[model samples]
Target: MQARDTTALHTAAATQSPEPGKKRDTGVRGTGTQIALARSETPAEGTRHLTGSRILCADLPRTMARFTTGTLSENRAMLIATEVQDLGQEHRGWADEQLTLNPEDFAGESRKALGDRVRALVQEIEPVTALERIDDARSRRFLRLIPTGNMTMRLIGQNPAEHGVLMHQVLSDLADSKTAAGKGQGRTREQIRADEFCGLVTGEQNISPRVEIELVMTDRILFQAEAEPAYLQGYGTIPAAMARQLVRGRDMELKLMRWIRRTGALDLDPRPDLRDPGLPEPGAAH
Candidate 1:
Protein backbone atom coordinates (compact mmCIF):
# COMPACT_ATOMS: atom_id res chain seq x y z
CA MET A 1 0.00 0.00 0.00
CA GLN A 2 2.86 2.41 0.78
CA ALA A 3 4.50 1.56 -2.53
CA ARG A 4 1.29 1.98 -4.43
CA ASP A 5 0.65 5.34 -2.73
CA THR A 6 4.19 6.49 -3.47
CA THR A 7 3.89 5.47 -7.13
CA ALA A 8 0.53 7.15 -7.46
CA LEU A 9 1.86 10.33 -5.86
CA HIS A 10 4.82 10.37 -8.25
CA THR A 11 2.58 9.92 -11.29
CA ALA A 12 0.18 12.59 -10.07
CA ALA A 13 3.01 15.03 -9.41
CA ALA A 14 4.54 14.36 -12.81
CA THR A 15 1.21 14.82 -14.67
CA GLN A 16 0.23 17.97 -12.75
CA SER A 17 3.46 19.88 -13.37
CA PRO A 18 3.05 23.47 -14.58
CA GLU A 19 4.69 22.65 -17.91
CA PRO A 20 2.54 20.06 -19.68
CA GLY A 21 5.41 18.35 -21.51
CA LYS A 22 7.99 18.46 -18.69
CA LYS A 23 7.92 15.95 -15.81
CA ARG A 24 8.62 16.82 -12.20
CA ASP A 25 12.20 16.24 -11.00
CA THR A 26 12.87 12.82 -9.50
CA GLY A 27 14.07 14.28 -6.19
CA VAL A 28 11.02 16.53 -5.94
CA ARG A 29 8.75 13.62 -6.76
CA GLY A 30 10.41 11.41 -4.19
CA THR A 31 10.25 14.07 -1.46
CA GLY A 32 6.57 14.65 -2.09
CA THR A 33 5.87 10.94 -2.07
CA GLN A 34 7.85 10.37 1.12
CA ILE A 35 6.08 13.22 2.91
CA ALA A 36 2.73 11.84 1.78
CA LEU A 37 3.65 8.40 3.12
CA ALA A 38 4.70 9.87 6.50
CA ARG A 39 5.52 6.42 7.83
CA SER A 40 9.21 7.01 8.52
CA GLU A 41 10.75 9.39 11.02
CA THR A 42 13.65 10.48 8.84
CA PRO A 43 14.18 11.15 5.17
CA ALA A 44 16.84 8.44 4.98
CA GLU A 45 14.48 5.88 6.50
CA GLY A 46 11.73 6.94 4.10
CA THR A 47 14.11 6.66 1.17
CA ARG A 48 15.20 3.17 2.20
CA HIS A 49 11.60 2.01 2.53
CA LEU A 50 10.74 3.60 -0.81
CA THR A 51 13.70 1.96 -2.52
CA GLY A 52 12.77 -1.46 -1.14
CA SER A 53 9.15 -1.01 -2.09
CA ARG A 54 10.05 0.04 -5.62
CA ILE A 55 12.46 -2.84 -6.11
CA LEU A 56 10.05 -5.43 -4.73
CA CYS A 57 7.09 -4.13 -6.70
CA ALA A 58 8.88 -3.55 -10.00
CA ASP A 59 11.46 -6.33 -10.14
CA LEU A 60 10.35 -9.09 -7.75
CA PRO A 61 6.66 -9.75 -8.22
CA ARG A 62 6.79 -13.19 -6.67
CA THR A 63 8.45 -11.91 -3.52
CA MET A 64 5.98 -9.03 -3.41
CA ALA A 65 3.12 -11.50 -3.69
CA ARG A 66 4.52 -13.51 -0.82
CA PHE A 67 4.94 -10.35 1.25
CA THR A 68 1.38 -9.26 0.50
CA THR A 69 0.04 -12.67 1.42
CA GLY A 70 1.80 -12.45 4.84
CA THR A 71 4.23 -15.27 4.07
CA LEU A 72 7.26 -12.91 4.24
CA SER A 73 7.90 -10.00 6.55
CA GLU A 74 8.81 -6.53 5.27
CA ASN A 75 12.32 -6.94 6.68
CA ARG A 76 12.83 -10.25 4.86
CA ALA A 77 11.42 -8.86 1.63
CA MET A 78 13.76 -5.90 1.94
CA LEU A 79 16.63 -8.30 2.46
CA ILE A 80 15.77 -10.04 -0.78
CA ALA A 81 15.42 -6.71 -2.55
CA THR A 82 18.83 -5.57 -1.32
CA GLU A 83 20.50 -8.84 -2.37
CA VAL A 84 19.27 -8.66 -5.96
CA GLN A 85 19.68 -4.88 -6.31
CA ASP A 86 23.05 -5.13 -8.10
CA LEU A 87 21.84 -7.64 -10.66
CA GLY A 88 20.48 -6.67 -14.06
CA GLN A 89 16.70 -6.61 -14.35
CA GLU A 90 16.54 -9.98 -16.12
CA HIS A 91 18.87 -11.61 -13.60
CA ARG A 92 17.06 -9.96 -10.72
CA GLY A 93 13.77 -11.38 -11.94
CA TRP A 94 15.32 -14.78 -12.34
CA ALA A 95 16.72 -14.72 -8.83
CA ASP A 96 13.42 -13.58 -7.39
CA GLU A 97 11.54 -16.37 -9.17
CA GLN A 98 14.04 -18.96 -7.99
CA LEU A 99 13.84 -17.75 -4.41
CA THR A 100 10.08 -17.46 -4.19
CA LEU A 101 9.01 -20.50 -6.21
CA ASN A 102 8.42 -22.40 -2.95
CA PRO A 103 7.18 -19.69 -0.63
CA GLU A 104 7.00 -22.09 2.31
CA ASP A 105 10.63 -23.09 1.91
CA PHE A 106 11.84 -19.52 1.54
CA ALA A 107 9.76 -18.22 4.46
CA GLY A 108 10.92 -20.99 6.78
CA GLU A 109 14.60 -20.06 6.46
CA SER A 110 16.18 -18.06 9.25
CA ARG A 111 17.03 -14.43 8.49
CA LYS A 112 20.76 -15.06 8.24
CA ALA A 113 20.26 -18.29 6.36
CA LEU A 114 17.87 -16.61 3.96
CA GLY A 115 20.39 -13.86 3.23
CA ASP A 116 23.14 -16.43 2.70
CA ARG A 117 20.94 -18.37 0.32
CA VAL A 118 20.12 -15.27 -1.70
CA ARG A 119 23.79 -14.31 -1.89
CA ALA A 120 24.67 -17.84 -2.97
CA LEU A 121 22.05 -17.76 -5.71
CA VAL A 122 23.22 -14.36 -6.87
CA GLN A 123 26.82 -15.54 -6.99
CA GLU A 124 25.83 -18.59 -9.02
CA ILE A 125 23.67 -16.64 -11.42
CA GLU A 126 25.85 -13.52 -11.78
CA PRO A 127 29.24 -13.95 -10.21
CA VAL A 128 30.63 -10.73 -11.64
CA THR A 129 27.78 -8.68 -10.24
CA ALA A 130 28.18 -10.39 -6.88
CA LEU A 131 31.86 -9.50 -6.78
CA GLU A 132 31.11 -5.93 -7.74
CA ARG A 133 28.56 -5.72 -4.94
CA ILE A 134 31.14 -7.04 -2.49
CA ASP A 135 33.63 -4.37 -3.55
CA ASP A 136 30.94 -1.69 -3.25
CA ALA A 137 29.91 -2.85 0.22
CA ARG A 138 33.52 -3.10 1.41
CA SER A 139 34.14 0.51 0.46
CA ARG A 140 31.21 1.62 2.63
CA ARG A 141 32.41 0.18 5.93
CA PHE A 142 31.88 2.59 8.85
CA LEU A 143 31.58 2.95 12.62
CA ARG A 144 28.74 4.99 14.03
CA LEU A 145 27.35 6.07 17.39
CA ILE A 146 23.67 6.54 18.15
CA PRO A 147 22.31 7.94 21.37
CA THR A 148 19.36 5.94 22.67
CA GLY A 149 16.84 7.76 24.89
CA ASN A 150 17.82 6.65 28.41
CA MET A 151 21.21 8.39 28.68
CA THR A 152 22.95 5.53 26.89
CA MET A 153 24.59 5.35 23.49
CA ARG A 154 24.87 2.55 20.98
CA LEU A 155 28.15 1.97 19.19
CA ILE A 156 27.85 0.20 15.87
CA GLY A 157 30.62 -0.81 13.53
CA GLN A 158 30.51 -2.31 10.09
CA ASN A 159 33.61 -4.21 9.03
CA PRO A 160 34.50 -7.07 6.76
CA ALA A 161 33.33 -10.43 8.06
CA GLU A 162 36.85 -11.65 8.83
CA HIS A 163 37.79 -8.54 10.78
CA GLY A 164 34.55 -8.60 12.79
CA VAL A 165 34.98 -12.30 13.64
CA LEU A 166 38.58 -11.74 14.72
CA MET A 167 37.67 -8.78 16.91
CA HIS A 168 34.89 -10.77 18.61
CA GLN A 169 37.27 -13.68 19.22
CA VAL A 170 39.86 -11.39 20.79
CA LEU A 171 37.30 -9.79 23.10
CA SER A 172 35.89 -13.18 24.03
CA ASP A 173 39.38 -14.50 24.84
CA LEU A 174 40.13 -11.51 27.05
CA ALA A 175 36.80 -11.89 28.84
CA ASP A 176 37.38 -15.62 29.35
CA SER A 177 40.86 -15.02 30.72
CA LYS A 178 39.60 -12.46 33.20
CA THR A 179 36.84 -14.84 34.29
CA ALA A 180 39.36 -17.60 34.87
CA ALA A 181 41.65 -15.25 36.83
CA GLY A 182 38.96 -14.50 39.49
CA LYS A 183 39.21 -10.77 38.67
CA GLY A 184 35.95 -10.79 36.73
CA GLN A 185 33.92 -11.83 39.78
CA GLY A 186 30.41 -10.32 40.11
CA ARG A 187 30.25 -9.58 36.39
CA THR A 188 28.90 -11.58 33.47
CA ARG A 189 31.06 -12.55 30.50
CA GLU A 190 29.38 -9.89 28.36
CA GLN A 191 29.95 -7.27 31.03
CA ILE A 192 33.60 -8.25 31.22
CA ARG A 193 33.91 -7.99 27.45
CA ALA A 194 32.35 -4.53 27.48
CA ASP A 195 34.79 -3.35 30.15
CA GLU A 196 37.68 -4.78 28.14
CA PHE A 197 36.48 -3.01 25.01
CA CYS A 198 36.21 0.33 26.83
CA GLY A 199 39.61 -0.17 28.43
CA LEU A 200 41.25 -0.89 25.10
CA VAL A 201 39.54 1.98 23.28
CA THR A 202 40.26 4.54 26.01
CA GLY A 203 43.70 3.17 26.95
CA GLU A 204 42.43 2.79 30.51
CA GLN A 205 44.03 -0.65 30.74
CA ASN A 206 47.29 1.26 31.03
CA ILE A 207 47.73 4.59 32.86
CA SER A 208 44.66 6.88 32.53
CA PRO A 209 43.33 10.10 33.98
CA ARG A 210 40.87 10.03 36.87
CA VAL A 211 37.23 9.99 35.72
CA GLU A 212 34.36 11.39 37.81
CA ILE A 213 30.79 10.19 37.48
CA GLU A 214 27.51 11.10 39.20
CA LEU A 215 25.24 8.54 40.78
CA VAL A 216 21.82 9.53 42.14
CA MET A 217 19.84 7.48 44.59
CA THR A 218 17.63 7.98 47.58
CA ASP A 219 19.30 7.60 50.97
CA ARG A 220 17.02 4.67 51.75
CA ILE A 221 18.16 2.88 48.61
CA LEU A 222 21.83 3.67 49.17
CA PHE A 223 22.04 3.08 52.93
CA GLN A 224 19.27 0.60 53.64
CA ALA A 225 18.36 -2.51 51.70
CA GLU A 226 15.60 -0.75 49.77
CA ALA A 227 14.80 -2.27 46.40
CA GLU A 228 14.74 1.07 44.57
CA PRO A 229 17.12 1.49 41.62
CA ALA A 230 19.88 4.07 41.32
CA TYR A 231 20.50 6.36 38.38
CA LEU A 232 24.01 6.71 36.97
CA GLN A 233 24.00 10.18 35.41
CA GLY A 234 25.44 9.38 32.00
CA TYR A 235 24.77 5.66 31.78
CA GLY A 236 21.20 5.28 33.10
CA THR A 237 19.58 3.38 35.96
CA ILE A 238 21.42 0.49 37.57
CA PRO A 239 20.39 -2.02 40.24
CA ALA A 240 20.70 -0.84 43.83
CA ALA A 241 23.18 -3.57 44.69
CA MET A 242 25.29 -2.68 41.66
CA ALA A 243 25.24 0.96 42.65
CA ARG A 244 26.28 0.09 46.20
CA GLN A 245 29.05 -2.11 44.85
CA LEU A 246 30.30 0.76 42.70
CA VAL A 247 30.46 3.07 45.71
CA ARG A 248 32.00 0.47 48.04
CA GLY A 249 34.48 -0.84 45.44
CA ARG A 250 37.62 1.03 44.40
CA ASP A 251 36.17 2.10 41.05
CA MET A 252 34.43 5.26 42.36
CA GLU A 253 34.87 7.66 45.29
CA LEU A 254 31.68 8.80 46.98
CA LYS A 255 31.13 12.02 48.95
CA LEU A 256 27.75 12.49 50.57
CA MET A 257 25.68 15.63 49.88
CA ARG A 258 22.12 16.72 50.66
CA TRP A 259 19.68 18.67 48.47
CA ILE A 260 16.22 20.08 49.29
CA ARG A 261 13.55 20.19 46.60
CA ARG A 262 10.34 22.15 47.07
CA THR A 263 9.13 21.67 43.51
CA GLY A 264 9.96 18.88 41.11
CA ALA A 265 13.27 20.52 40.30
CA LEU A 266 16.72 19.27 41.30
CA ASP A 267 19.56 21.76 41.64
CA LEU A 268 23.11 21.00 42.64
CA ASP A 269 25.76 23.56 43.52
CA PRO A 270 28.14 23.79 40.55
CA ARG A 271 31.30 24.05 42.68
CA PRO A 272 30.43 21.41 45.28
CA ASP A 273 33.59 19.64 46.47
CA LEU A 274 34.79 17.13 43.85
CA ARG A 275 37.03 14.11 44.31
CA ASP A 276 38.22 11.19 42.22
CA PRO A 277 40.67 8.85 43.95
CA GLY A 278 40.87 6.68 40.82
CA LEU A 279 39.06 3.91 39.01
CA PRO A 280 39.63 0.29 40.02
CA GLU A 281 42.41 -1.62 38.29
CA PRO A 282 41.22 -3.50 35.20
CA GLY A 283 39.93 -7.01 35.95
CA ALA A 284 40.06 -6.24 39.69
CA ALA A 285 37.23 -7.65 41.84
CA HIS A 286 34.57 -5.06 42.69
Candidate 2:
Protein backbone atom coordinates (compact mmCIF):
# COMPACT_ATOMS: atom_id res chain seq x y z
CA MET A 1 0.00 0.00 0.00
CA GLN A 2 2.96 2.31 0.22
CA ALA A 3 2.84 4.55 -2.87
CA ARG A 4 6.59 4.47 -3.44
CA ASP A 5 7.66 3.13 -6.84
CA THR A 6 8.48 -0.58 -6.83
CA THR A 7 10.65 -0.29 -9.96
CA ALA A 8 13.68 -1.19 -7.87
CA LEU A 9 12.19 -4.60 -7.38
CA HIS A 10 12.90 -5.68 -10.94
CA THR A 11 16.65 -5.79 -10.42
CA ALA A 12 16.49 -6.96 -6.85
CA ALA A 13 17.96 -10.43 -6.35
CA ALA A 14 18.03 -12.43 -3.16
CA THR A 15 21.52 -12.49 -1.67
CA GLN A 16 23.06 -15.03 0.68
CA SER A 17 25.81 -14.93 3.31
CA PRO A 18 27.86 -18.08 3.62
CA GLU A 19 27.65 -19.72 7.04
CA PRO A 20 29.93 -22.69 7.44
CA GLY A 21 27.66 -25.73 7.37
CA LYS A 22 24.76 -23.26 6.97
CA LYS A 23 23.70 -20.14 5.06
CA ARG A 24 22.59 -16.58 5.65
CA ASP A 25 20.43 -14.31 3.50
CA THR A 26 21.73 -10.86 2.65
CA GLY A 27 18.69 -8.73 1.88
CA VAL A 28 16.47 -10.95 -0.22
CA ARG A 29 14.50 -11.67 2.91
CA GLY A 30 15.05 -8.11 4.08
CA THR A 31 15.87 -7.23 7.72
CA GLY A 32 13.12 -9.16 9.45
CA THR A 33 11.99 -11.84 6.95
CA GLN A 34 13.45 -14.92 5.27
CA ILE A 35 13.75 -14.29 1.50
CA ALA A 36 16.98 -16.29 1.36
CA LEU A 37 15.26 -19.32 -0.12
CA ALA A 38 15.83 -18.18 -3.71
CA ARG A 39 19.17 -16.40 -3.29
CA SER A 40 20.89 -19.12 -1.37
CA GLU A 41 24.37 -20.55 -1.99
CA THR A 42 25.17 -23.69 -0.17
CA PRO A 43 27.53 -22.46 2.56
CA ALA A 44 27.77 -25.92 4.16
CA GLU A 45 25.89 -28.89 5.58
CA GLY A 46 22.59 -28.21 7.36
CA THR A 47 22.48 -24.98 5.34
CA ARG A 48 21.61 -24.21 1.73
CA HIS A 49 20.20 -21.43 -0.38
CA LEU A 50 16.47 -21.72 -0.90
CA THR A 51 15.50 -21.32 -4.53
CA GLY A 52 12.17 -20.20 -6.09
CA SER A 53 10.30 -18.20 -3.47
CA ARG A 54 9.33 -15.18 -5.60
CA ILE A 55 7.11 -12.35 -6.94
CA LEU A 56 7.46 -11.46 -10.66
CA CYS A 57 7.41 -7.72 -11.28
CA ALA A 58 6.43 -5.57 -14.24
CA ASP A 59 9.22 -4.11 -16.33
CA LEU A 60 9.28 -0.36 -15.44
CA PRO A 61 9.68 1.22 -18.89
CA ARG A 62 6.72 -0.60 -20.37
CA THR A 63 4.59 0.57 -17.47
CA MET A 64 5.53 4.18 -18.17
CA ALA A 65 4.62 3.58 -21.80
CA ARG A 66 1.15 2.55 -20.71
CA PHE A 67 1.01 5.56 -18.44
CA THR A 68 1.91 7.89 -21.34
CA THR A 69 -0.78 6.30 -23.49
CA GLY A 70 -3.21 6.74 -20.56
CA THR A 71 -4.31 3.17 -21.23
CA LEU A 72 -2.23 1.72 -18.44
CA SER A 73 -4.90 2.00 -15.81
CA GLU A 74 -7.69 1.27 -18.26
CA ASN A 75 -8.66 -2.37 -18.70
CA ARG A 76 -6.48 -2.82 -15.63
CA ALA A 77 -3.61 -2.68 -18.05
CA MET A 78 -1.35 -1.50 -15.23
CA LEU A 79 -0.80 -5.21 -14.93
CA ILE A 80 0.51 -5.58 -18.49
CA ALA A 81 4.07 -5.29 -17.23
CA THR A 82 3.18 -7.21 -14.09
CA GLU A 83 2.85 -10.82 -12.97
CA VAL A 84 2.45 -12.86 -9.78
CA GLN A 85 5.10 -14.58 -7.64
CA ASP A 86 5.16 -17.03 -4.75
CA LEU A 87 4.18 -20.59 -5.49
CA GLY A 88 1.49 -21.91 -3.20
CA GLN A 89 2.15 -24.44 -0.43
CA GLU A 90 0.56 -26.91 -2.77
CA HIS A 91 3.37 -26.22 -5.22
CA ARG A 92 5.77 -27.26 -2.50
CA GLY A 93 4.23 -30.72 -2.36
CA TRP A 94 4.29 -31.06 -6.12
CA ALA A 95 7.77 -29.58 -6.44
CA ASP A 96 9.05 -32.07 -3.89
CA GLU A 97 7.53 -34.84 -5.98
CA GLN A 98 9.54 -33.65 -8.97
CA LEU A 99 12.76 -34.12 -6.97
CA THR A 100 11.76 -37.74 -6.46
CA LEU A 101 11.86 -38.65 -10.16
CA ASN A 102 15.05 -39.87 -11.92
CA PRO A 103 17.09 -37.10 -13.52
CA GLU A 104 15.89 -37.54 -17.17
CA ASP A 105 12.41 -38.87 -16.47
CA PHE A 106 12.05 -36.42 -13.62
CA ALA A 107 13.08 -33.63 -15.93
CA GLY A 108 10.44 -34.38 -18.55
CA GLU A 109 7.49 -35.10 -16.28
CA SER A 110 8.38 -32.29 -13.90
CA ARG A 111 8.59 -29.88 -16.81
CA LYS A 112 5.11 -30.77 -18.10
CA ALA A 113 3.61 -30.72 -14.66
CA LEU A 114 5.31 -27.39 -14.19
CA GLY A 115 3.85 -26.12 -17.46
CA ASP A 116 0.34 -26.99 -16.35
CA ARG A 117 0.94 -25.79 -12.81
CA VAL A 118 2.49 -22.50 -13.88
CA ARG A 119 -0.37 -21.97 -16.32
CA ALA A 120 -2.89 -22.49 -13.58
CA LEU A 121 -0.84 -20.16 -11.37
CA VAL A 122 -1.23 -17.37 -13.92
CA GLN A 123 -4.99 -17.82 -13.97
CA GLU A 124 -5.08 -17.41 -10.21
CA ILE A 125 -2.60 -14.54 -10.45
CA GLU A 126 -4.63 -12.23 -12.74
CA PRO A 127 -7.61 -11.88 -10.44
CA VAL A 128 -5.49 -11.45 -7.32
CA THR A 129 -3.60 -8.59 -8.97
CA ALA A 130 -6.85 -7.08 -10.21
CA LEU A 131 -8.36 -7.17 -6.77
CA GLU A 132 -5.45 -5.10 -5.40
CA ARG A 133 -6.82 -2.13 -7.34
CA ILE A 134 -10.22 -2.53 -5.76
CA ASP A 135 -10.29 -0.71 -2.43
CA ASP A 136 -13.80 0.59 -2.94
CA ALA A 137 -15.31 -0.18 0.42
CA ARG A 138 -18.61 0.82 -1.13
CA SER A 139 -18.91 -2.70 -2.43
CA ARG A 140 -17.69 -5.45 -0.10
CA ARG A 141 -19.47 -8.03 -2.20
CA PHE A 142 -17.64 -8.23 -5.49
CA LEU A 143 -16.79 -10.99 -7.91
CA ARG A 144 -13.10 -11.81 -7.67
CA LEU A 145 -10.88 -14.57 -9.04
CA ILE A 146 -10.50 -16.58 -5.89
CA PRO A 147 -8.80 -19.95 -5.81
CA THR A 148 -11.53 -22.54 -5.96
CA GLY A 149 -9.71 -22.87 -2.63
CA ASN A 150 -8.50 -26.07 -4.21
CA MET A 151 -5.45 -27.11 -6.23
CA THR A 152 -5.81 -28.78 -9.63
CA MET A 153 -3.76 -31.06 -11.95
CA ARG A 154 -1.78 -33.30 -9.64
CA LEU A 155 -0.15 -36.07 -11.69
CA ILE A 156 2.46 -38.72 -10.76
CA GLY A 157 5.72 -39.71 -12.53
CA GLN A 158 6.44 -36.11 -13.47
CA ASN A 159 10.16 -35.28 -13.59
CA PRO A 160 11.94 -32.12 -12.48
CA ALA A 161 13.58 -31.44 -15.86
CA GLU A 162 10.23 -31.89 -17.56
CA HIS A 163 8.79 -29.30 -15.22
CA GLY A 164 11.74 -26.97 -15.75
CA VAL A 165 11.36 -26.96 -19.53
CA LEU A 166 7.58 -27.01 -19.52
CA MET A 167 7.26 -24.36 -16.81
CA HIS A 168 9.60 -22.03 -18.70
CA GLN A 169 7.65 -22.47 -21.94
CA VAL A 170 4.19 -22.32 -20.43
CA LEU A 171 5.12 -19.42 -18.24
CA SER A 172 6.52 -17.80 -21.34
CA ASP A 173 3.22 -18.37 -23.12
CA LEU A 174 1.06 -16.85 -20.39
CA ALA A 175 3.47 -13.94 -20.10
CA ASP A 176 2.70 -12.75 -23.64
CA SER A 177 -0.12 -14.97 -24.79
CA LYS A 178 -3.22 -12.92 -25.52
CA THR A 179 -6.79 -14.01 -25.09
CA ALA A 180 -9.90 -13.24 -27.16
CA ALA A 181 -11.88 -12.36 -24.01
CA GLY A 182 -14.99 -11.81 -26.13
CA LYS A 183 -13.53 -13.20 -29.36
CA GLY A 184 -14.33 -16.82 -28.36
CA GLN A 185 -11.09 -18.28 -29.75
CA GLY A 186 -8.33 -19.39 -27.38
CA ARG A 187 -4.76 -20.55 -27.91
CA THR A 188 -4.22 -24.27 -27.69
CA ARG A 189 -1.24 -25.43 -25.61
CA GLU A 190 0.74 -26.11 -28.80
CA GLN A 191 -0.21 -22.78 -30.30
CA ILE A 192 0.82 -21.02 -27.15
CA ARG A 193 4.34 -22.53 -27.21
CA ALA A 194 4.75 -21.94 -30.95
CA ASP A 195 4.18 -18.24 -30.44
CA GLU A 196 6.44 -18.11 -27.35
CA PHE A 197 9.49 -19.71 -28.96
CA CYS A 198 9.43 -17.49 -32.04
CA GLY A 199 12.37 -15.33 -31.01
CA LEU A 200 14.40 -17.80 -29.00
CA VAL A 201 17.64 -19.47 -30.19
CA THR A 202 16.55 -22.83 -28.68
CA GLY A 203 20.01 -23.51 -27.31
CA GLU A 204 21.05 -24.12 -23.71
CA GLN A 205 19.76 -20.77 -22.44
CA ASN A 206 16.46 -21.09 -24.31
CA ILE A 207 16.00 -24.77 -23.51
CA SER A 208 17.97 -25.08 -20.31
CA PRO A 209 16.52 -27.36 -17.66
CA ARG A 210 17.18 -25.26 -14.55
CA VAL A 211 16.29 -21.58 -14.30
CA GLU A 212 15.67 -19.00 -11.60
CA ILE A 213 12.96 -16.47 -10.73
CA GLU A 214 12.74 -13.51 -8.31
CA LEU A 215 9.57 -12.23 -6.65
CA VAL A 216 8.78 -8.82 -5.10
CA MET A 217 5.57 -7.18 -3.94
CA THR A 218 3.70 -4.42 -2.10
CA ASP A 219 0.32 -4.16 -0.36
CA ARG A 220 -1.06 -2.46 -3.47
CA ILE A 221 0.47 -4.46 -6.36
CA LEU A 222 0.75 -8.15 -7.10
CA PHE A 223 4.04 -7.76 -8.98
CA GLN A 224 6.09 -4.72 -9.84
CA ALA A 225 4.45 -1.41 -10.69
CA GLU A 226 5.57 -2.01 -14.32
CA ALA A 227 7.37 -4.83 -16.86
CA GLU A 228 7.89 -6.22 -20.45
CA PRO A 229 4.77 -7.76 -21.93
CA ALA A 230 6.48 -8.78 -25.17
CA TYR A 231 9.09 -11.05 -23.62
CA LEU A 232 6.43 -12.23 -21.22
CA GLN A 233 9.26 -11.96 -18.76
CA GLY A 234 7.08 -12.09 -15.69
CA TYR A 235 3.66 -13.53 -14.86
CA GLY A 236 1.00 -10.74 -14.91
CA THR A 237 -0.90 -8.52 -12.51
CA ILE A 238 -1.80 -9.92 -9.10
CA PRO A 239 -3.59 -8.82 -5.86
CA ALA A 240 -2.12 -7.29 -2.69
CA ALA A 241 -2.66 -10.32 -0.47
CA MET A 242 -1.11 -12.49 -3.12
CA ALA A 243 1.79 -10.04 -3.43
CA ARG A 244 2.54 -10.17 0.27
CA GLN A 245 2.37 -13.93 0.19
CA LEU A 246 4.68 -13.97 -2.82
CA VAL A 247 7.29 -11.78 -1.15
CA ARG A 248 7.38 -14.34 1.68
CA GLY A 249 6.21 -11.70 4.11
CA ARG A 250 3.53 -12.03 6.75
CA ASP A 251 2.18 -8.44 6.44
CA MET A 252 2.13 -5.42 4.13
CA GLU A 253 2.50 -1.64 4.26
CA LEU A 254 -1.11 -0.70 3.52
CA LYS A 255 -1.74 2.86 2.27
CA LEU A 256 -5.09 4.12 1.08
CA MET A 257 -5.85 7.20 -1.09
CA ARG A 258 -9.17 9.08 -1.07
CA TRP A 259 -10.70 12.41 -2.19
CA ILE A 260 -12.82 15.03 -0.37
CA ARG A 261 -14.04 18.55 -1.18
CA ARG A 262 -13.07 21.41 1.12
CA THR A 263 -16.78 22.24 1.48
CA GLY A 264 -17.77 18.77 2.63
CA ALA A 265 -18.15 15.69 0.42
CA LEU A 266 -17.12 14.94 -3.14
CA ASP A 267 -19.18 16.97 -5.64
CA LEU A 268 -18.23 14.66 -8.48
CA ASP A 269 -19.22 11.09 -7.68
CA PRO A 270 -16.31 9.52 -9.57
CA ARG A 271 -13.32 11.74 -8.97
CA PRO A 272 -9.83 10.59 -9.87
CA ASP A 273 -8.27 11.89 -6.64
CA LEU A 274 -8.62 8.43 -5.20
CA ARG A 275 -6.70 6.33 -2.74
CA ASP A 276 -6.72 2.63 -2.04
CA PRO A 277 -6.95 2.13 1.75
CA GLY A 278 -5.89 -1.46 1.18
CA LEU A 279 -9.18 -2.96 2.26
CA PRO A 280 -12.89 -2.87 1.50
CA GLU A 281 -14.59 0.11 3.08
CA PRO A 282 -18.27 0.60 3.98
CA GLY A 283 -20.06 2.39 1.13
CA ALA A 284 -22.62 5.23 1.39
CA ALA A 285 -26.02 3.99 2.53
CA HIS A 286 -28.15 2.82 -0.40
Lowest lDDT sum, 10 consecutive residues, model 2, at 45-54
The reply for model 1, stretches above 4 Å from the true place, is 14-29, 32-37, 144-154, 201-286
In model 1, what lDDT does residue 101 have? 71
RMSD score of candidate 2 (Å):
23.3
Best by TM-score: 1
Which digits, one per residue and each the tens of the lDDT, describe model 1 over residues 156-237? Answer: 9776443454457667778877888898989999999888888978877752223344667654444453445555553444
User: Pairing residues by index, what is the TM-score of model 2?
Assistant: 0.17
Best by lDDT: 1
User: In candidate 1, how many Å is residue 243 off?
Assistant: 48
